[model samples]
Target: MDIGAIAAAVMLAVSVRKRLDVFDGPADITTSLMMVGPLLVLGWLVAIALFGGYREDVFGVGTDEYKRVFNASLVTAGMLGIGCYLAKFQLSRGFFLLAFVVGIPLLLMGRLLLRSAIHRARRQGRLQYRVLIAGSPAHVDEVAAVLRREPWLGYHVAGALVPAAHLAEETASGIPIVGTTEHSTALVSTEDADVIFFAGGALSSASQLRTIVWELEKAEVQVVVAPSVTDVSGERIKVRPVGGLPLMHIDPPRATDAARWGKRLFDIVAAAFLIVAFTPLMAYAALRVRLHDGGPVFFNQVRTGRDGEHFGCLKFRTMVVDAEARLAELHAQIGFEAGLFKMKEDPRITPPGRWLRRFSLDELPQLFNVLRGDMSLVGPRPPLPREVAGYESDMMRRLRVRPGMTGLWQVSGRSDLSWSEAVRLDLYYVDNWSMLQDLSILGRTFGAVFGSRGAY
Candidate 1:
């Protein structure tokens, strides 16, 4: 893909150069560009390969893959400029600019496509690695839960190797206990695991951990150490090498940055554009809801916002006028879990309400709230007063940022998400808030809504 991208870029650059008339003609060059293009692309490919673009660990996750490609491109451009200057080669100025400008984005797009394919493959249970976890019962369960939560990460916990004293057939969360540390080495090859994880246990100490790592050295499988840290983004953690140890320095969470002007400006611009673009659709949905039973066109309910302030959240009325009155009756039937009120099949929802909620047209009115500065385009969901009353201290972190129309919770599973999982996703967004992440989530919202995977 990289080679193809570069070749396409060269063609594009040549045409752009001709259009701009940067030089007398293609013959102004000391040599034929078509012939030189291959050599240039080969150099770029070699630079990327030498810069670790093909490393196995970078394939499945993180921005490291993009970073390596970007760095390699910059270096290749620099070396090409120096070489051309020394060789007295008159590379068309317009072509040089167009090549890098167009080529880099094309290369990145290729990587994005490649990653999407890998994720799709992993979710289908193809290209997954069998993983063996070695840890105490508690740590083992925690690791397994994370793996199960994100199957696209391509890790399937085959079994656990717990301490000899805590041996069992399986730990909680259904990860079968394969064996104790006595058979740890044999189990890796026996289970045909592609990776072995060493979490907390008797192996918590450095010396013991080193011994275990050495034991698995000859296993020929990747060995990963699950640190005590969890839920921290890689961007916030930096590795600082001390005398003989690698110390991880973590930057404080960026929850406050969520309120910065950049995000507010982004919300305002995006919300206004969406409102203008969807006005006809919103009008049609509102008309349908009103005609369904001649109820109100919009639902305005007080919800908690940033800093615990109250605001009226707007949505197309997707339920009967007596929906609130019937809430308690439904709660009694299902028995509430985790203080969240939801039902897969609630009698209160009107006929049009189901489709409205399914496509998320009901949430379109919230764009007004976003423009009003009462909410953001992407943040935690706005909680009701009753829900806020039950929030634990940790859960209150979500209030630091404005509530969002669609968030991690919505994209992940919407109404089907467990309360705890919802809180975790919201807090993760608050701590790791970035404009790039917000745009990515917004793009994904369409897929989630259309699929109606967890929407009622």
Candidate 2:
């Protein structure tokens, strides 16, 4: 709606300029007819709003939000452009170009400003949601801690209802314990909660949870459940309604060749283009690696790719030549796991590596891998073949797709994710593979890389 209105203004400027003829001759009464064009544009603007283009919440966070905005606006513009052509209205090409160029950024900026303002209001407590939590004390405490930390999420922990036999005194986060499990339905209405979170393992019985869900239906409060399983992504869970019951089906992970050919084609073209574009920069990076530390510019190591294949992964050397040798020493000092080692303040990182890692500059050389068909523009994380050797059957699903330079795990919290979370995301990507989805992930990669949320 905002975009259409803005575009209408642009069209009006065109009509006014073309019809006025003020630079050459005096304006005539027929010039007043130009107002009719703007009136029609206003009608189009209302139509666009009625088509669901004006709603903001669907575009709240992540790429889906921006996708909805862009897709809807483009559809509306395309239809309007067609209508003008069919009606034999000779609109200025400049008018259409100007409107498109100006309107998209304007609408995007408007949404950004609105989101910021709403977040600010939520932080100030002017906008808040009263919520009831249902679960064991531990789960209740975990949920409560997150809410307390980020008040802008808008949840106000009103109270809790524990299972009757647990005998837990109160939530560790200090929300009052209001009722026993038996009176869960009554307690929600009394507290007038906007949302109810069924927290943790204590809600072991689905029949009981369903009964509570049935009661909440009458109260008209939103219900969210925290599953007992940890580190599960929602994409992997499918709720199928069979007969009268909703059965949760967990889909096994697999990447098929149905879209694989198209994806491979896309990666080939995009990677080929990027490698050419960044050749000079790559050359400079190679120089820097040699100058900073007199060693090899490109570090090649064996990494696992699709279907357990080993490929030489290329990265700009971001550490000392002896970094591999020093790993055991550092692990001994830090006492990390034999298989998975992390040195928070590793001394092996070169000065350039630290800066390179910070902004993801070190990964640029992987364009060669992408072009060589050993990697993809987007897919699962490339694990060491050693890491793949230890994979559970479920973890092996990540190898179905070609390893990517940037992927779901890359953009989604990066190293901050637990190993289980990373595997879940990788599997989810393989199961739900789409070229459009890959494009969306690639767009988000910029923000993730630049934001540096979990780089090292």
Candidate RMSDs in Å, in order, are 2.4, 5.5
lDDT of 1 by residue, 192-300 (tens): 9989888888374677767766887887788887867878888889989898688999899989998999999998898999999999999889889988899999999
Give one digit per residue, the lDDT tens place, for model 2 in 36-92: 356445654565466555664454444445555566667757876787789876555
Given candidate 2, what's the lDDT at residue 30? Answer: 34
If scored against the real structure, what TM-score would every candidate get?
A: 0.92, 0.75
Candidate 1 global CA lDDT score: 0.87
**Clash count for each candidate, listed in order shown:** 0, 1
- Segments in model 1 whose C-alpha atoms lie over 4 Å from true places: 15-31
Specify the poorest-scoring 10-residue window by lDDT in model 1. Answer: 22-31
Best by TM-score: 1
Q: How close is candidate 2 to the true structure, as a TM-score?
A: 0.75
lDDT of 2 at 254: 38
